[model samples]
Target: MAETKKYVRIKKASVDGVWYADKIGNVYEVDRENCVSILTKRGIRGLSSVLREDAELIVTEKRPAKVGERVLITVAAPIGKQAYETGDVFVAESLYDPFAKDIRVLGIPDFIDYNEYEVIVDNELKNGEADGMESTYVRKQSEGLDRVAKSLGYVELAKSSLKQNGFIGEVHTFDLLTECAERLREQAQTHKEKIERGYPEFSPVHKSAQARRDEIVEQAKADVERLRENNIRLRTFNISLEVNRKDRSVEAIAKRPKSNRAFYGIAKAAPSDCFNVHIGKAIALRRALGLGVPDEYLNAPQPAEVRVGDVVYGKYSEAYYQLWCEDEIGDVSYEVKIKEIVDGKYRYVGGGYDFIDDADLTIIDDSREGVVGE
Candidate 1:
């Protein structure tokens, strides 16, 4: 039988404004028009056009299902229960009390029944899956046995049969296992899918909601840390790479902002490609962070001697240096003077050793050194 089988569409006008319990045991006060639409849309057997008084008949299932729990589904023949026979064997799908008390039962093997199993539970069946209805149903709880829950398709068929035989009022759950690996796998798969889709929901019975939320928050925090650690930023505080469209000038401002936005680092020559823009940004950021940058770029040319204000825009320019993919996958190794270390790195802080004897440590004055005229 198809996993999703459509059965006869039962439309009862009298069912309008009737309070009926869905397959999940939830009672809905649906009007006649909506009731027919819902039942037909669900197309599951055992569905009834309940009235307001029947609303009180709605009972919530509390006990959970266990693996290998013996179930005697009182459905018609061809769906695990032999035709004209009363009971059939099936398995529970989940380890503990899942969202639903659906069970899976088998069908009569290698035989066809004159009557067909009605599609109920909205095609929720592996063979004879049923809802958590009580009354005349026997449940032998699992006694710590490695048993798998029955498929829903088979159980649905049986559930429909039970409804047909007048035993579809209230469903109950019994035989809950402590914990099952299969159930864990299901939850894990759901969790994984949600994460991949960026809609993670940690509502597993095994874990607390706070625990799930904490894990997600921690994971996100770790990711942000990783990005910040491995990546470099050139913001205005660090350095501002502003392109003046008025004069087509690219100004690189170091950490200390000026009232006039002094161009601490500017490239007078037009860059061949976009790489120079990045280079300019890096230079400005490195200067702002007090890295060991040449005095020429800082517009404050001083002796190339070990000093506090010297900056150097550092990068992995080695032949074997590969662009960093992630987690320092292809980082080039280099040693810098740690005299002006900041944030535990010499690249961002000005902690480098520059050996320049003061005797001849002199620099030519350039009026337009830092201010690159467009």
Candidate 2:
């Protein structure tokens, strides 16, 4: 078996100052026998003759990274022939041998992906993205919101296209993102309320570990009292998990006086304690913008029909969109919807038809007052 090793990205460089290739990819080869290769140390299979602190690419490029004129370019290269996934950022430094037919290009890959960068941008973690999100800590919280707001590849592109096409910032959406954000806030509020009601472990998704914070607090007080009565100075008390030998049942246990912050940080919370963070964020943003949630959103939204004679707009548009038929296609794919030209150049999908089946517009669903002419 050819040892099945896969790398999402690979950095190739000329080990002996002999590698060269084009910036696009596919490096050049000089002196076939003594072609570009990575230097070998005593035991390390991965040794580089490259100039930077990056892993050595086995091939050099025309855009060589010389000692003084180091240039950087971003490109994709698969190591062990692994296919590239979305959001992979690869940068390269190479030296081209213009004198001869071959130029040694040192490839440098910074292999940073969204998930591995340790920031949660998926719609799932929007509200509480801060609990453990790195971008929030590294940058400002507003930047973090913007990052997650346009986190999806399509979402980012749609925003960029709307802005580029002179659409107002508020209308920079192909779907009812604002309405969805409000919906997220409502969801977050519910989640937050449940947590406040001593049920931090509650979640619509994921199995929740029941919250025993109050019980823990009471137990902590009793523990401190017991220690005081026993003539032991209760310096600090902390809660921990212990396995019972009687029935092999694992349960939380309260112990004493570990550190100054023990009692405060000792309470039991939901697992990961980061549920509904994004929803909270969405809610806050909507309130800041003077937006309110629909009354129906308080409970389940009633099914509404999209019909003819209604005016609508594309997810990202300033021109009002017009509908095609007087019939109802309340739920259908956006691709099937006919395009009504608002202006000579500006066109939009016929309105009144929901794009829930659309790969992009499903984020909005039926929230907000969107079924009628706007």
Candidate 3:
């Protein structure tokens, strides 16, 4: 059997005279033996041949799905007529009912265990995204009103289309479109109210990129608290992992209380990828803990082109965020939906849509980690 493995992300710049393809912020998957073959200018090379102290382990965890939310099947679970295959998506109807021994989904008659599927996006955590915006409460209200105005235009178009089509005996289609428009209007109102309630005065949106980056410094302090709760065996009381995002680079500062000495871990995302705070924290923690970094982080495979459904990091004008590419726009751009912080996690949400130039996007997914070459 193949050895179970994990991913590692690089955190530092390459040194002179080194022959390995060690670049900052690239992530690579490695086997239990800490080995991965990477594609380099010199052809494929073993990542283990170089020093691994510059990379840190990446922990991938799945957040639980809630009732009425969407989930993606990660494993095949065939049960009579309600058979589910991997890569399938369905809406969950109910959560684990101790009486049923599984969870229920809309179309499936059978129940599935929690391990079989993962939440597509946690809707509850989506509200935090407004916290990332730099706009004030009044500006947010104006944006919400702008969406309502756009929705009104769409509703008018639907009505005009219905008027033209109703005379042609396509009444059912027109009715459905009209109904959808009504729902869109209702949703817009609801969104406006939600944003009003979640204004900057109450939730406090960041004023600048650096202001947002400063939160990562505090995140290190919080991470220490989290480590104490989960990693009881690890010594966390003396350790602090502070992270800061500057442009495409995320820096982590690890230190002990009142100490002049501190260790730093820095991860710079590639020009085509978004900066990730999680990667920065991992690298910084590893360096602070006096542990050797993993090999794969320095030599992971990178995507050369964007594809539909790819998760990319890029900026839409002044707002920096992740996007889910929905379709190709012309030859050099894509229609994308912004990934929002839904329930404290990043998810591809509805309504936040725009076109992004391919030149401005960076592919961030790292599933192709263990492959030997391009």
Candidate 4:
């Protein structure tokens, strides 16, 4: 069998000088100056230390680093083919030696547990030890300063909350409370002025009582005059004359016609003979005339008696006749009802009328004909 190859995941070392972490804890940095082909031939182990400080280590899985903690190094590179060919080192969790100070050979703890306290390499603690046992006391003093800073921050935040809430509450209460005080002051002043002037406050009940007394006096006087007028007109007799239109004579004993109801008004027909007769009013006139058929319909053109295409005209005025005709044969001139009048032009609907028989109907154009009549 052929030699089995180990499979390793790969990742880019950097993007635009920014570093990323890979599966393993070891970090690597990329240099834009070196190409992949050059790095593969020359190898990357020697260059690893120079770039180590700039490399950022990112732990994707729950490995050594906590959820939000980050490593101080730069970019991470993948393992396997490209990395191997490029002479890039593959990192495993066990291989990191973090305790070693030299970047050339580093070591890490055997295993890291999350949320557990572990002692990191304290370079400052090591440097301070040279100053003797007094250096320990200085370290404790530095911790006290940190606590003071945190406490001051919380106090300042509380003061800001008090000022912001106090200002808003004061402004709202002052505006509404001041307005109520001014209204009360005005009412007190008005009451004092009314008392000094010796004038009673105007009230509707007092005015209504006085008005009722005056109304009763006027009503008594009107009742006395009304009785006197009733006695005078009651004795007066009214003589009305009924004229017989056929005989052109008046009847002495004739009572008023059922159609004529005006008593005191002059007996005269409507001044304007032209009147707008609605359908209901025309029906009433037909009943009074004892005409079994409606006069409006009787005057209307008969569709059966008239030919399919016949011309008829309306004598609206003595000088003009509005033309009505059919445009086609087998077309009847049905009932023409006036629907509306707009701008002195009467619009009517002709029922059962055909336009196919007569295409040309004479429309009287007086202006074009040069007629003498106005």
Q: Best candidate per lDDT, number?
A: 3
Residue 370, candidate 3: how far off, in angstroms?
26
- Can you tell me which runs of candidate 3 are displaced by over 4 Å? 1-47, 50-237, 257-261, 303-361, 364-374
- Tens digit per residue, CA lDDT, model 1, 265-355: 5543232211122234444444434455322222211223222322232334433244433344454433232234244333323333322
lDDT of predicted model 4: 0.28
Runs in model 2 lying further than 4 Å from the true structure:
1-110, 113-213, 232-374
Query: How well is each residue in 221-316 modelled by candidate 3, as lDDT tens digits?
Result: 365356535444453335544444344454555555467766666666666544444444555565655655443333332444443344555544
Model 4 C-alpha lDDT per residue in residues 303-374, reported as the tens digit of each score: 211111222223322222223433333333232333333443434445332232332222111011121221
TM values, all candidates? 0.16, 0.15, 0.28, 0.15
Once fitted onto the true fold, the runs of candidate 4 whose alpha carbons sit more than 4 angstroms away are 1-170, 200-218, 235-374
lDDT values, one for every candidate: 0.32, 0.28, 0.47, 0.28
Best model number under TM-score: 3
The clash count for each model shown is 46, 37, 8, 21
Candidates by TM-score, descending order? 3, 1, 4, 2
* Model 3: residue 109 alpha-carbon error in angstroms: 73
Candidate 4 least-lDDT 10 residues: 33-42
TM-score result, candidate 3: 0.28
